[model samples]
Target: MVTADRRQGRRRADPPPRRRRLPESPPPPPRSARTWTWTWGTLLVVAALAVLLLGRTDVLPLVAQRGAAVVLTTLYGVALAVRTGGRPVISGALCLVLGVAGVALAEPILLSGLVVLTGVVSAVLGVMLTLPAATFPGVVREVLVAVVVAAAGALAIEGYAAEVSRERLAYVVLALSLAGALLLVFRLGAGLHGLGRRGSVILAAGLGAVTVTLAYTEALRRWASPGLLGAFESFVAQVDATLGGVPQPLAILLGFPALAWGVSMRARRRQGWWVCAFGVAATGPLAVALASVGLVTAGFSLLYSLLAGLVVGYGVIRLDQFLTGPRGRRARQLEAASAHRPEPRRTAPVL
Candidate 1:
């Protein structure tokens, strides 16, 4: 009777799940290297089609016609949704549509639209996923701060470019470097919090060594490059002459701290550190190109990536320890075994 009642309740609750039309069955899963081979091949095809579609159209004005970018991103979101169970695909689709819309409007409405959309989208997605997207109350403030720093970087880059008479390019770069580093460091703090004392110390030392060495290597590259700093310097000089305000935007964009900051803060250990390092390394070239229009951008790109990588690597390892702990897993197993065995009671000594 109970089983019958329960079945009836389930029937009432779901209403039979109605026979839904399903997507077509895919081919059997490929093994080993075939997996990557297939995935990459599919991606290339999709990408080619998307490019052909977006490229031939003169949709929005040039800068925003970055629809090809949007398509790639949207498709990638769909792909991630497949791998990560759909969170990113959903979130990214929302971001793409909204971002494109914001970019489409005329001025007085355009930039404002972009800013509002950016904040709203971030807040909404963060809530949907339980990520700390800075609460709605403080999100605007944070966005504003990010904007200020990015704008400052852009203005400074512009100043450097156009040969504005100022002894302050060094100061501007210094400020941005400090701000970006601090952004990364604060991000690392999350990882550190996850790591307790012992794990934290060991991982810190390891990450520190790695970050320092990487930074040094990048510094060496800057010194060794054929054009030296001059090649870099002149690149900015040319940008200034051509487009005045581009550098600051590029700098702000560059200073956005590697995405690995999230993973680095999550793991506080081996896997986390690796994820953070890999993400930053993967993005290094792009970041460099995005930060400046010329040579200096390349040098700083390598420099910032190395620094961020090292910082996140060190921090993630530390946190991983705290979250998983050294003895927690083993202790649980031992306890489980003990629970199954009868306790050996001891007699008290005759008193």
Candidate 2:
């Protein structure tokens, strides 16, 4: 090759660098399918078992009579523990120690603590999947599914073996719990938060706490007040007479959650005052009774229904916001007002 010579008095430029474009990456598949895979799989399995074994007396009475609940509980506990993958919370060492203590004690409190722990762990796992690859997100969902199934299965077994002086009340409580829980779970995937979740949760918690409180009070030999006692008698009469097919005190129970939800959504002043009024209305003269199926219990039933309505309404509004980006009401109103005004006309001078 000849040696290169430098240019003199002549401008020289370097050759332009070639630009190469990289191929664009394809968009990822939608995650709905993945989440559905686990949720559906779980629903299918549970549904199949329920359907197949539903009519069979063999499966019906077996668990209760045989203490199958304990087994189910153990299985559930283990499954959650596995799901957690022993992720540390607070402290790893502390978790291990407490977990071991809980195990060694086997007391009800300890066991209950463990159950709550597992739930917390499962939730954490779900939150964890919200980031990064979102890889195997369904795995965490499956684990939660497993937890609910196991807990319900075990509880059912326990309930069946449970001895209640009055089978009617026992069945009623169980039925209500089952119905409410079922409702909660059915809409679980719908992701109720703004109103749906908060409402439902409030309803569940408020009603649940009140019912438990009443039961405990009664257990402790507490007697109802004169008016309350009269209502109780009326409740007894209606139930015994078969006058109506209404759940007792359901409205009052329902009112708590609904009212709580309204307070959550609106300011403490505007909505809270009204909500408080209605709540007191439920608790006060039992005015909500008029809405109930039963003569005496309708007032409380109405109260609860009102609360549920509020919650559902609030939730719907919030969900709308989430789905369709938030917009100001004042801005929309102003735009509407402007639209009605005459359009501006341009004036041209003589050319």
Candidate 3:
């Protein structure tokens, strides 16, 4: 009876309904997806091998060969995307459209478009094939994958008869590769907030070094006095003659070390991806190295780069150990077990 007066004043509010409990994390991918991914990768590799071997022969028409190459390269990119956290169906559909367009634009008249597509494909393959590793040996394994992918991309780009300047092609490929890699790394590292003070400084310094090198080279080429330009070219020629070719500065100085240290860091933290993004400096130039320099010089150059880069990577690993790893050998071993958590399998989606 008294409740009637209470209702007139203000009825008691009902408690909000309990919301459904959400998952702590997304479920792992189905077994079928992983199996299909491996199947597709194997088939694509075989197809690519066949094309590379038979590409010069009359067994397949030139147009058909190039078309197959473009499609295969694009499909590999889609597979990489899926393995690196992309939706399989969507990436597949989008890559399919791009592949068709690439095949259609295979004519000499449309060479520029093909060059652009080649750059896109190479960048995608270069960046997506990489993952943060736990040790220097793992980083070396990743580098090998990058080398193979780049070589395949180089072959595909070289299939066309028309030639764009090597400098222009290299620049395009590097720029696109850097952009895509940075974007992916941003997501992988959990955005700007994830980059603590040390990470920010390291990333900034690395970027500055890369930018200055690129800018200085371009300026010397385009704006330096004729005498200076000639002198530079002469020096480069002498170096090439003496050493086959010097290791790429970008790869030796920054890319490989960053990859090594970043992966080591990833064993403890996510911010390592920010550093690893610079690895494209090595892989980007690699994609166009063969196309620009010819087989023998490119081979020697890559060999030198690998050796120098490994040396740098080793130094980086030791420095990281000094800074952050445990005090003694035994402690370090125990710390490694505690800090270096297991990651997803190489062929699985990391995210």
**Window of ten residues with lowest summed lDDT in model 1:** 342-351
- Give lDDT tens digits, candidate 2, residues 224-326: 5778777867876786457333433432344333334333323211222222212221221121122112324443443344445444534643453355433
Model 1, 75-192: lDDT tens digits are 4334323432345546666756754664454343433333322222221111111111211222223223333223222322221112222223222333333333333333433445
RMSD of each: 18.0, 17.0, 4.5
Itemize residue pairs with steric clashes in candidate 3: none
lDDT of 3 at 257: 70
Best by TM-score: 3
Better of 1 and 2 by TM-score: 1
Per-candidate Cα lDDT values, in order, are 0.36, 0.35, 0.72
Model 3 superposed RMSD (Cα)? 4.5
Per-candidate TM equals 0.32, 0.31, 0.82
lDDT of 3 by residue, 3-58 (tens): 89777556556566799998799787699987886887778867875775476455
lDDT, residue 25, model 2: 100
